[model samples]
Target: MTELNLELTKEIELLRLVTVGSVDDGKSTLIGRLLVDTKGAFEDQLLAVRKKKGETKIASAAEIDLAMLTDGLSAEREQGITIDVAYRYFATPKRKFIMADCPGHEQYTRNMVTGASTASAAIILIDARNGVMPQTKRHTHILSLLGMPHLIVAINKMDMVDHDQATFERIRQDITDYCAMQGIKDLICIPMSALNGDMVAVRGENMPWYDGPTLLETFESLPVLGQLDEQAFRFPVQLVNRPQTADLPDYRGFMGTIASGTVKVGDKVMVLPTGKSSTVKEIVMFDGNLDEAFAPQSVTITLTDEIDISRGDMLVRGDSMLEPQKEITANVCWIGDEPLEPRKKYWMKHTTNTLKAMVTDIDFKTDIHSLEHEQSDQLAMNEIGQIQLKLLKPIYADTYANNRATGSFILIDGFTNNTVGAGMII
Candidate 1:
């Protein structure tokens, strides 16, 4: 790519967003509308959707099925319900978007977590006929807990209510009240009909009394969260490169994506656990060496001094105050079929480090409906609870509120080798 082209690509910011709602709340159809209206779908894809018009629930026989665009799985298409997270990419003149279509069924809440974990914003779809449902509240609570910065509530199916402004106002008020209780600071509400493509990508002649940016306009103008580079530096070493070739026998590089902050050549850094210090000698990338690197950039770094470092070790700024810890308290969401067993060992994978850990205590389980904390001895499937954990080996970390990249972890079942739970450090 040319220099100007590369610069232009960088200027078009990429926003990661997740769409969530109750079951049959038009989540899929809204996504389909976005893709189709933006010309993101290809001719072949549109033709396929038209062929499967019979499967559409909201669209009429004369109209094509837009939901099929994201519900790629056969099971999802057959049931007309999202069962897994489907990611789709689209771009406009001013911005680009990576949209994750998350499942809405109660059983698939785990999948929703996976999608929303990295999202900067979320779009919550509520049916116009039905106000805020239990499932909508549950999803909102989870998103709030995840520290989502922005939310867009799209009141869908307005065509069914004859574009009545009264119905839109009622649902909008309920959503606003609920979100305020959840401590969501940034929110936008739009009345849209995904089936008729009104107020989704384009503003149709419906609900003239209600005036706000269209869903597409809101996404294009929404402010993203603070840049990760402004946070503290964290580089968890994922690999160590040592090519014993005659050309460069002494070459040694620590490779990983910078979790946060920035690093430049000659900067002082410390190796974690070992507490050894070194100066950055080089910042190596595929094309060439860079003068500096920042968070989320995958690059190999060579230090001025040879320190004992390997996978699972972290490199931080020399003046950083972070330290390794053996015990931590975290808010955990249990997704396993079996209930959480206290004192039972499970593999905890935090960043690039994996170690044996066990739950020391169960503080309490959260009631999704009422948002109340109730004392509980065990956590069942799709339950959120605070728990204490003891790790066999100490690992450097931070609070999830400070840095999500280093503060979040997954619990793997030792016997089944499946991810049973996800936790955020307190």
Candidate 2:
């Protein structure tokens, strides 16, 4: 195929991925090199970053630190830490990718949560010398808990180990055992030297014994659209678009991003909270009308009848959907500086619905490494536990394993507006 044809074909496949690991395990470097070697980085920009590759460069180490490419914040540059999720976009001949480079510190686990919320797959990096450490276990455990079905374990720094297949096998077995205990079954292990560009964007002769696909090759083989299509339909109204003026008078529409599934014109839909029924009259994107809309696509939807609908309302197919529930049980990861308090109400935002919720009971605390659950009264910062919650009003939700967008929620300090916890609805 011609270059233009190849580019056009690739536009049909889009992948959203996240890279995670312990501090200095080459998570960012792997992403940076992947983007750079794929010709995803601009020449002028890469040259500018390359100019500072020397001993005097205080921002990062000498030897062209690829991690610096994604570490954009001044605060991060000074401290040598990633405090928030940094996103980058790049496309290859076979696919378009949106990469989220998540933070590695235990304190910034919330950042990882934010990134993982949207990722379809995750690349968990581990240094060959370190093998499987506590933080590696923590990252992998969190990935499993968050229900990321596709996982790639890149055992980096193979060069430092003289590319020994025995060493690679040992580390791979360790990770396999760890993840197996956590109930994460789908895993791909690759021995790579991200610094040397070995088996990253291109196949290398150094690993002739390894017949598995390279990183880029693996991406090309994945069914990105299939996974995106597997989700059930969910549309949460962000804002009720209504213009009562003379121009486009009596235009009442529901504007929001489709959380999952597909919606089509003239489809029978049910409005939540009020339980009103209506048909989708039109699906409008900014440019024009659309026949259908799927997950991650933002569009305005007009209904045939003037049924009552408002912000925080949900539109769904009348059949095969869960009813709204006032009481919910969830696996909670406490991210706040203060511990979770019982009987104190916190603001919960699930999809588009915001309501007050109080913790009714604590079931158990989860140990990430051992996959053990111990009964606990409260969850402290960076702790994961199971809790029962009572919401002021019913919210339509799915089990986290079913649909991530509608099943997960965030807890905020009602008075301070600070996000305190991340929860997966069970």
Candidate 3:
């Protein structure tokens, strides 16, 4: 197909974004305000928020409290704090959105990490009263290290600072320098008040000095992602279908979501870690067979040769450059209460494969506040550091920067079987 044809047929995607910051940075309120202004909130919900006005900080007498649109939990409403990730889906004319309103407290940092893991962009809220606190720096580092492509430092609650121009610019400069140090290029800083609805969903004329896109405008105008489809094909086998019945005794199908690139009938494919080669015989889905398949499509495939394959095996183009290896160096985030120390054992799960692994060495940990790499013997809870690991079995992997789905892994506790940490292969 021609490039024009491909572009014409390109799929539009729902933008997934997470809002994060320190306590009282208005992560929930920003989402609530957006929902209210865009008519995403229901009349009943608005009535409920208005009934709880005695507990709310929004000073508007006639307006319903926007914070009530989120903070749905009873405990959250009573305490006026967000404890979990509150999700709200709303759409504008240009693009649909799935927003995760992550908790800002220090203890819920793990939950915050989970919210932003799959997001393409992040809106880091900064209270105009409290600029660039430790949590602000920490969340920024977390988002940047997680490979979030776009970062919008939403300096929220500008009303508290009397919409001071100096307050906005100083925070912008500080965040810009910090993002640059982390090697993040796509950073946008916006001034807004989530409570008063200024520069959020609507242009509240209060901030006439600020000349930039509103939050809704930013969401609508941002480009979509199609780079994964252009890369090498990666299909991690999730399951093997072998309905050996009387009617179809010889049928065997490999099933999984395509992680990247495209494959079609007759393409030469290779099963990873076992060097078995085959040709694509058929691409089957619930409906029917497809002439071709690309990234993120779930399909069952039948290969020309019945090679030994199972769940956790990766299928790729024969000439694809991804390598399978046993020992890989990775930047790891230690999420467990215990430290990630040398000689510790954990189950390292990459893609669909899981195996025993040992912490071999500690390279260094980043100081979020300063963006400095400090040598460390161990990484404690919520600490991010580079580490070496010895895997008991070989697996196909790539750098996190190259292919997100294939290059990331998680460490599970041997005793509790809990996810203790996340690893990005370097």
Candidate 4:
């Protein structure tokens, strides 16, 4: 492997993206083409794919079955359909990419969400021949709901359409008209043929009229999302670090990943749910002690006072004064097989905290196709709806739009111990 691919530098930022759309839209193949064109695929992997293609007669003699590179599961290979999200990692000289090849089938929509929840961008594939299917809207809606910063619509199979500019325009125009009503402006559409290796990683010569940088270029150009360092400081206490030894006798450190903003040695911080205040005495890291810490960095904090704190408790800026909330109306995506009924008790786990909560009311569910609110008594699997919940314990929370890490939660069924729903505080 090249040094650029192997070496993860502090300067080289990670960009995470997820591929979503209808089945047979070539999501896996597009990812494979990217890996192959960029030398991301190993020679042994290519040989294995070539061998499989010949043995199973899955592809023509000359055509490379690029989908084989990502559809690694035996069932995925046999069925020729992606049932689970497949992740592929590849790095360019400029950036490192973690691309999730999410299943396009409607049944696997939950799995698609699981992949996309952490993505900085979502590549929603649309077959040029199909234009914009309902599945396209479903995935788009999910992306918007999850606050995905970028949406790159890959209109694939341009080769099948003879690389016609008019066909591409029509599909693009239709999508434009559809999304215009939604008032979402983060979307960018690109015409490409993942199967024929057009406009994916390489600049194919077939389409003389379609002038645009390849998909790889577009990915490299995305601005970093979530300036957490600028936001208010939030650190949920996950562990009470107290390693007692001869050298250091009385060390009491609070350990957790910072949810947002920065913290210094003398910052006045407040513990949530208890309202106890303390000054940050020191910042402890794996390497050594640090003078400062920032969002998303896991570190241990020593407070000036031995304050009452435990797991699930949060530490934040005393000046921010974020109120602990108990009753909240939030948008929820029901991901379980069982329906989410009103007044039903479920364990609501948010960040490091888990508490018994009840869905007080089922406000309305979104008709993902129509993009309209529909009356619903309960939320079914793969359904997105508005719900009011009452938590057994109040949590220091923020709106998901403000801080994704602090606002999002999951519903666990007590009996089955299954995560049944995902919620975002509005």
TM-score of each: 0.91, 0.90, 0.88, 0.91
lDDT of 3 by residue, 1-426 (tens): 122344433544578888886446776667777776666666666767774544434334236655666768888789887677878887665567888877777545576678887777889888888888877788878887788878888998899999999999999988888788878899888899888888887778889998899998898767656387898899999999999999989899999999989999999999987888999999998888998999888999999997999999999997885676878899887779888898999999889888999999998988756768999899988788899999998888978888889989999999988999989998
For model 2, the stretches where C-alpha displacement exceeds 4 angstroms are 1-12, 47-62, 106-108
lDDT of each: 0.85, 0.82, 0.82, 0.83
Go through the candidates in order and give the C-alpha RMSD of each one to the true structure. Answer: 3.5, 3.3, 5.0, 2.9
The candidate 3 region of ten consecutive residues with least summed lDDT is: 1-10
TM-score between model 2 and native: 0.90
lDDT of 1 by residue, 281-391 (tens): 999998999999998899999999978899999999877758778999999988898889789889999999999999999998999778899999899888899999999
As for TM-score, the candidate ahead, 1 or 2, is 1
lDDT tens per residue, model 4, 185-297: 77787899887778887778888887877799888888755577889998999999877988778888999999989999999999998898999998987788999889778
Off by over 4 Å in 1: 1-11, 51-62, 78-80, 162-170, 207-211, 223-225
Off by over 4 Å in 3: 1-12, 51-69, 72-81, 129-131, 160-167, 208-211
Locate the minimum summed-lDDT window of 10 residues in model 1: 53-62
* CA RMSD (A), model 1: 3.5
TM-score of 4: 0.91
lDDT of 2 by residue, 106-182 (tens): 46467777788778788889999889888888888888889986889998988889888888899999999989997
